[model samples]
Structure formats: structure tokens, C-alpha cells
Target: MQQRTFEDFKFNKQILNAIEEAGYTIPTPIQQKAIPPILAGQDVMGIAQTGTGKTAAFVLPLLMNLKYAQGEDARALILSPTRELAMQIEENIRQFAKYTDLRAVVLYGGLGPKTQIAELEKGVDIIVASPGRFLDLYLAGNIVTKSLKVLVMDEADKMMDMGFISKLHRILEVVPRKRQNLLFSATMSELVHKISGDFLAFPTIVEVSEQATPAQTVTQTLYYVPNLKTKINLLQHLLKDDETLLRLIIFCKTKTVADNVFSFLERKYGAENIRVIHANKGQNTRINSINAFKEGTIRILVATDVAARGLDVSNVSHVINFDVPIVIEDYVHRIGRTGRASQTGDAITFCNPAEEYYIRKIEKLIRQQIPVLDIPGEVFIEKTGFEERQAIAREIDAQKRKDNPDFSGAFHEKKMANQRTNKPQHGGKRYIGKQKPVRKKR
Candidate 1:
């Protein structure tokens, strides 16, 4: 088959101009497969990983269908799992609709809704929102979904994981039943699949790549570190080479870890070079951090998984998984941040003993083992703490039990025996306890 170009899609002059300006000369695989069906008004279920140009696949067609601004109430609603993603979709819409007169607004939590409500009142063609904020505005009678022509659930899998199913159902109940639906996700989990059945009507399934697979452009490597401090040591050692480690993102499992990593990097690289973002950070702070990272002002962004999916900074030279994600699917998303736009990048994961279990799960999910690399001799290796060792042991034992219900691991037996040994002798202490209470009263 001959290669297809954006012009072959027969997009309007406005969309074509914007595409040209955005420097998109050719359609990605997902765009090639998904855009046609979506433009035909068919429900689409897009299964693709991050950084695969899935955003434009749907956005371009949605913009084409919208054509020009008609009514005040939003004609299309795009739901995202996180504020960052909602903002990203809105930005894409703005970029694609730049030549057109279409108006778009973004609604999400952790920020004031007053401005968003004002935008809705003024009238918008597209409303990109997180589930909770969307429902909140809908309940307040500020949003009228009767005119909604398109309903898109971007990152549906993540929405379900974030416990937005009930909210989704509520939104579905309110929106017109006949509108076109588009569902996109990195993975097709049982929950996402089930929810898609409810949301879409005979949707066209678009699978550009295997589910949970990282982008092929990324070179992945794994390092088995002993503990958290040692992970930091490795990070510092890698960052010392400013040329190869340019514009890095460090993914931590929790906000506390992200903050800790940020503090360490800030102290070493200076506050101007490093910024951290997580759920606890203020809305303005998070946005500023992301902007700074994208502008190349910040060399490193220490973030929790919140930034894993939605962030789209170009030319990220390296992505370091400071902590392995417990959700194995997120490994793909985290690494996907790098190696975007057909640019080669490195994804280096630092796995401690406990995280090794998660790494195994991630490897299995991705259907490929990450090539292990020996730690650099210059990086100081820290010994695992007693508590961390015990935690890892318990986790391993739990995994063993999960594999075989009847199998009792060493920890289980030791725990049970120790409990029995610590148990007070049945009746021996009762008389002494009563006598001691009486003496205290006297």
C-alpha cells in the first residue's frame, strides 16, 4: 500500500493549515486508522500507548466534524482521568482549531471553577474536563449536555482505575444517548472493556500497537539498586554527565518520594534546574513546573505517576524511573514520556529488591525483559535497611502464597510460631493480676 499523507484525509483548509504549521506532514498509524472512522461518525475504541499521536487522531476529526462554532453549550465533551491530561487535550484542540472560530475550555479539580464557569457561560464548542469537575459543573446546572454531539473518554482505563466509573455512569445518564462516543486507552483491561461496551455502540476497534508495549523508539535499561538512597546515588552519577542526561524526568511512586528526590536534585543542581510535581502540589505550582520543564528551563522534573500520562515535553533525553510503578501498566506510560515524536530516548529504571517483583510483573506485561545493566562502580551502593528487607520478604512471601494457596512461606511459619510463643500462658497470670490491682487501690 502507498503511504498516505494528511492531505489525503481531505481535512478543511483550517485543519490542513494548522497541521502544516504544527509540522505534521504524515499521519501516524493510529491517525491513519482512527481518523477516518471517527470522521465518518462511527464510534471508535482506540487502543494505543502514550506518545503514539492518539490525541491528534481523534482531535483532528472532532474538529473537522465541529466545522464552525454553532451554539453556546459545548457540542463536544472530552473527559480525562487527570487535570494534566484534560489541559493537554484542550491545548491540542486550541492548536488545531487556531484558524477556526471554535472555542474550547478546560475544566479540572485543584483549581477554581469560577473562570471555567465563565467560559462555559460565554459559550464553547469543546469542553475538556476531568470526570469529577465535569459532574460537579453539570450538577450545578452550569453545563447543558443536550447539545453535545461528541462524547470522548480519553484514557478510559485510567478513569476507571481512578474510580470514576460511577461518575461516568452519571454523566452518561445526563448526556444525550444518541451522540457519538470515542474511547481511548493505553491498555484494554477488563474494567475498561466492560465500560466501553456500555459507552460505545458497535465501536470500531483501532489497535495501532500491542497493548502495554512501550514505544520501540525508546532504549530501555534496568539497574538493580540496593535501596532508595542508592537509587539517588545512581541518579546523581548519571546527571553529572549533562550532555546525555539533558531534560530528564524522574518518576517516583509517591508524592513523598517525588519531593525527596526533588529536594536532593534541587540541592545538587540548584533550584532553578529542578522542579517537582505531584498531587499535593498546588494547581499553579504544578502548571508552572510543567511549563518550565517544557520550556527547557528545568533540567529535571521529579514527579509522581500523575505526570506520567499527560505530560508532553519534547526531546526528553532520558526518563529515569526512580521508583517502579506498582501498576505495571504505568511502566509503559512512564517510559512513553521519552522517545516521543520519533525521537530516540533512553528509559532507565532503578529497581530495588522489593521493586524487582514489580519489575518482573512489568516485564511480563510488556512481553519483554528490560536489559539489566550493572551499576556504575563510581556510584556508592547503600545497604538495604532492616525494615525495607522485612517488607520485601513479606511481599515475596505474599506472592508465593498467591501462587499456591496451600504453600506457607518461611515468614508465615515464623510469624505464627512467634505469635504462639508470645501468647500468655492460659490461666497462670490471672491470680497475680487480681492481687496487683488490689494492692494499687490500697
Candidate 2:
């Protein structure tokens, strides 16, 4: 609990003013530990979870470095896993550099590349980017990376998880290896370690919090739902409760499931009351949905894991994990959406039998047992486990396919080929032979 005022950091007056304007009175732990090393032009590996002010940790020092080299070409490049996070980092930089003449631009996919290209042509001081679109523009000679002085890998763990290793490698090869490197992540996995090994030279390590640790303010609970349908009912019941009815973000595992949950909630509640956001939705739609949620115009926002990254909304009363995330770290981040800025909040995870493994992983990461609550009533209890239903559906589908003698010759041929070799399935769902329908279609 080391409390340091912004003035102590010796940030430029412009940046200090911007920080004051942004309402960040005190420096977060990561920021205090990281900014000095970064200012000294040292490679840094910062490990901190969401809501820990990791962005400012690098941004403040990077801005300080850029202030002297203002007229030079793009001196900094910050890579984020999602467009939203890229935009977020860039926004922070913009606010911090308002009085300074340093320019900043965000380059990402899902929007027109023309504006991004034009910005690159104009030569920005900082560029916050997602890996894919940035490389596309860079390789096309639309953006220059040869003079890159600082490279910040924001959410480095997620980049590796998203299979951006190759892209990162390619970008690294092109940029000046002698430049300052900063890597930040909520959790440090083996993959993240490997990636860091490649990108960072001898680096200053900063670990403000334990790996995958949830914020202390977040109150986590597990609701036992027997099936998916009942989980929905439980969610409705929970939301209707007076205390839980405030601004909420419901995390779904996939885009389809998010859409389905959104539609169901809208129909059950009111269309105007809830909004669905995911990668499948347009950029404007996602931004609008998030803004609406922040403004309280939309009480509920159902979103996939990717789209929910870097969301800065405050006062989110509850975060419902409608679907337990495949990746355990995601559970930490999802719940982190609430319980931010020292405010107490609730995170209710709806767990089905099949998803128990995911929940266990989450609990292991957070190093605590999530208190479980059984859904009230026999009907609700029986209908709670959505993961089990999904597993059953897959099993039924496999059985139907196996039993279908006339399903397809090619399918059987491929299946038999795999079976003959006795190759183990990668994901480890048992191969129950498909079932054929007895009724014939005329």
C-alpha cells in the first residue's frame, strides 16, 4: 500500500494536468513500480491483473520519453490483443499528451484502413495497434517501423493465446532490436514467458499482484444450475433482485451464445433494456452498446470475452458468467469488469456440470473456493446445467451421425480411417458411435 502522489513521479506538467483531468489522483502500485524503470529505458516485464492501472504504468513513462523526441518518426508502438484495448491505450495517451504536440493513432481491423493509413503517413508519435491490421499496413509500406524507439506489448499473454506469436516475431524482426521493450499482462503463463524471452532483453520484472489473482473487492459466487435453460431463469431471478439490478455485464463464451443470451434476455425483459455485443457485431454497434451500458441507457450488456476486453465502465454492479470461459484467466478478467476502483461488487458464475472443470480452473487461479448457491425449486435445479446440455447435444449429434448408415459415404470413410489407426482425439470427448434414425424419409 505505497501511496505516491502524481507530482512525486515528476511527470511533465502537461501529463500531470491530464492525469488530474482523468481523475486519477493516486498512482496504482504497478504504475509506481514500472514508470521509473521504463523512464530509465529498461526493458520491463510487468505482471498485474485488470483494474490495476497497468496502462498508465507504461503510458506515463513512454510519454515522457516521447516528449523530447516529439519530431522524430513514430517513437512508440503499443500492441494489444483487441481493437478495444488498442483504442483504450491510445485514448489514455491522447489525454495525457493533450498539451504536448505528440500525435497518436490507433490501427486495428473492422474499420476502414484508409484513415489508419493516412495517420501513419502523417507520422504519429505513438501508435496503438492490434497485430493483424498493423502488420498488414506496415508490410504494405503504409507505415514505417524502422525508427521504432519503444515497443510495448500490452496483454502479452493474450497475444500468445490468440496465436499472434508469428506476427509478433515478424514485427520484432523488422523493428530496431536495441529499442526499449515493455511487456504487460494480467497473468504470466508458459507461453507468455516464452514470448517475453524472445522480445525482452535483460528486463526489470514488476509483479504488483499474484498471477491470475482476482481483485479483492470482487465478491465471487457460484450458482448451481442443472441446465442452460434454468441458468437463464436463475439469471432473470438474480437480476430482478433489488440489489443486483444495477448496471451489469453478462459474459458469454461465444458470439452465438452471447447473441442467444441477449435475445432471450431482451424478450424476457425488454428489448430496450439489454444490448448484445461481440466480435460478430460491427464496431459502432459494440462501442454504442458499451457507451449505453456506461450511461445506464442499457441495464444489461451480454458480450463475448474478446469484445469485453479493455472496457472502462465504472459502477458495474454485477458480472454474470452465463457461460464459464474456456480459458481460466478469462474468468478473472470477466469478473474484474465489476468490483473496480475500490468499489465492492458481485460476480455470479452460473456453472453446469460439464463446465465444472472450467470453474475449478478459475477457483484454482484465484486461489479461493467460490461459495455455491443451489437454484431454488426442483424445476430450477433440474434445468441449471447448460454445459451438460451442450455436452449432451454434442453426444446426441455424434450418435445420430454414427447411426446414420446413409449419412454420407465420405464421412464414414474418414471416420473409419481415424478409427482404424486408433488415433486419440485431441480434445478428449469420448467417441460414442453415431446413431441412425429408424424412420425413413420418403
Candidate 3:
């Protein structure tokens, strides 16, 4: 069978030239399925995993719809969960609309909106923005949603996870009632379904992959490290083979872990070769780090989940989960950083005893078990420290209790024993005083 190409999309000459210049000849599954519906002015609900060219699926059709720049107010609005994703969509628009005069302005927080407002005043055909910033500007009269012909929510599942439903509603209320709506998400949760019902009218449902599943291009592996130190040590061992682990991303669950991993790697690999990014870092700093990693100037990038979405660096060789993600859905997004654009890559996860709980849930969510490998003999497995051990124990107990309602953990038993010892000598209360004692709330 002959493979379908971009030429079949019937895009205008400007867009075709731009697509050719971008070196994209073949349409991804999502693009092939979702583009026609969107171009036909129908509501579209696209459910595809990350790194499946979802951006182009929506962006290309929107570019075709907009045609060229005309109005002083924006005609299309694309809302993303994070500034990184919004900027990424903006770049995609620029790439596909290079030969045309269509204007796209990206609006995000973590910085003053003066520049963004200035751009909006100059007239834009498309606006890519984070939900909070989008609402803020719209409420402040900088954004004119009356002229909006299309509304798109990229990473719709993420937006719901980040508690953007109310803001989404607000944005929806302000936009024209008859505009085309397009919703895309890697996974469709109940919240996403509810929003889709509210957003789309007779929508074309397009799902290219299984929900919460990574691409086939990625090979996954697991290591049962004892604790943080051993995970770091295993990372060191992995990085020793620089040829295989050329460009790597280390995803930690928190900013602290990301900083710790970055500092350790910087000590050994030097700051010039490693960069870290998280919410604590300034916006400019995070953007610079992402750019550096994408340019291959840095061999390793340590990041939190903030970098998990819309990081379109194509040549990432490997992704190491320094810590298992508490949000199981993020596991899909984290590993997705690699194996993008149909390139083969590796995803290695380091799971300690406590984190093993979350890893189990992640396995169930993804419907697959990661193949575990024994720790290498050359890599020293340090003894778990007392504090870390206690913390792990507490976490495991909590997880067990969460699963079983009747589960009385050791702490519960100890508390019951302590209360028994402190109880009245007799079953009856205040026998000596022959009076009822007032009881306090526990």
C-alpha cells in the first residue's frame, strides 16, 4: 500500500512550501486523521499520545483555516497547560506559516505581560497562551475573543490535572458561541470527557494510540535501587558509557531532587555539560536551559515535570527517571521526552523500595510491566541510611493503608498500645471520684 503524504492534505501553496522546507513529507497518524475534520470546520477531539505530531495535526489545519493575517484581533486561540507548550505551539505556527503573513503571539506568565500586550495591540491572527495568562489578558481587555473563529486546547488532560477547568470555562464563556472547537489530549480522563462534551458539538473523535501508552519507538527498563544514593550511583554508572547515553534527560519528581541530581552531575561532568530546570528557576533561566539542551551544547539536562510536556528536542538519546513520578500519568509524559519523531531511544527508571508503590500503579496504568535488571556488580550499592529508611517505611505503611481501609499499620498498633497503657485502671471512668469526667476530642 502506498503511504499518504502531506500533498494529499490539499493545503495552500504557502503551507505546502513551508511543510516542504521543514522536511516533513509524511503525515503522522493523528495529523492524517484529525486534520481533515478540523479543516472541514467540524469539532475535533483528538486522543493521541505525546510526540505523535499532535501539534501539527491541529496547527496545520488551523493555518489552512486562517489563510492569512487580516484582523486587528486574534482569530484563533490555542490554550496550553504550560508556557513551554504554548511557546512550542507558537514555534510550530511560525514554522508552518513562514511563507504567509499570519501573525502568532505567545502569551505566558512568570514574566511581565507588557511585551505580550504590545504584540497583541499590533494585531495577531493566532494567540498561543497558558490558561491563567490567557484569562488574565482577556479579563484585562488585551485579548479580544469576539473575533476568534477557532478554540483549541492542547494537552487538555494536563489542563484538567493542573486545575484549569474553571478558567477554561471562563475562556469558553467569553469566546464566540459558534466557533470551531478542537480538544487534544494524550489520555482521556473523566474530566477530559466532560470538557469534551461541553466544548465540542458533534465532534470527530480521533485516537491514534492507546490511552496513557508511550510510543513503540521507546525501549523501557527498570532498576530496583535501594535509595537515593544508589540511584545516583547507578546514574553515574550509566553515564560512564557516554557513547550510548549521549544526550540524556534526568526527570526528578521535585525541584530539590532535580537540583541535587544536577549538582552531582555538574561536580563530575562540569557545569558546562549539564543544566537543570524547574519551577523554582526563573523563566529566562528555564528557557535558556531548554534551548541549550536542544542545541546539544549540554549533554545532560536534569528537570522536573515542568519540562515533561512540550519539550520537542528530537535527538534525546535517553530519559532516566531519577525518581518515580507520583502522578502516574506523568510517567507517560516523562518517558515521552525520548523516542520522539520516530527515533529509537531508551527510558530507564530507578525505583527504590518506597517508590516501588507508585511504579506498580504506573505499570497498571500503562498496562505493561517494565523489565527489571539486577544492579551491576561494579556499581557500589550503599546501605540505606536510618532517616531514609524510616521515611521509606512510613511511606510504605501509608501506601498500604491507602489500599486497605482496615489496614492498621504498625504506627496505629503502637498508638493503640500507648492509649491502652494510659487508659483508666478500670473499665468504668472516675471510680474514685464517683463522678463522670468530661472527655476531650481525640
Q: What's each prediction's TM-score?
A: 0.92, 0.86, 0.93
**Which 10 residues in a row give candidate 2 its minimum summed lDDT?**
428-437
Query: Tens digits of per-residue lDDT for model 3 on 33-104?
Result: 998888899999999999999999999999998998897999999999999999899999999999999999
For candidate 1, list the clashing residue pairs, or say none: none
On TM-score, the leading prediction is 3
lDDT of 1 by residue, 48-152 (tens): 989999999999999999999988899999999999998898889888999999999999999888998999999989999999999999999999999999999
- How many steric overlaps are in each model, in order? 0, 16, 0
Q: Tens digits of per-residue lDDT for model 2 on 1-442?
A: 4548988877889888889998999888888899888989999999998988889889998888878535536889999999888888888888888878888989899998988887777768888999999899888888777778899999887888799999999888889877999999998899899999998999999998888899889988898676777787787678767665588899998888888888888888898989988888899988888778888898888889985568878899989999888788888888888888778899988876567766777888888899997676643544424566667556445545666855555446677787798874535444454643345479
Per-residue lDDT, model 3, residue 172, is: 84
Q: Identify the runs in model 3 with alpha carbons over 4 angstroms from their true place.
A: 1-3, 413-442
For candidate 2, the TM-score is 0.86
Deviation of model 2 at 262, angstroms: 0.9
lDDT of each: 0.90, 0.83, 0.91
Runs in model 1 deviating more than 4 A are 1-3, 401-409, 414-442
Better of 1 and 2 by lDDT: 1
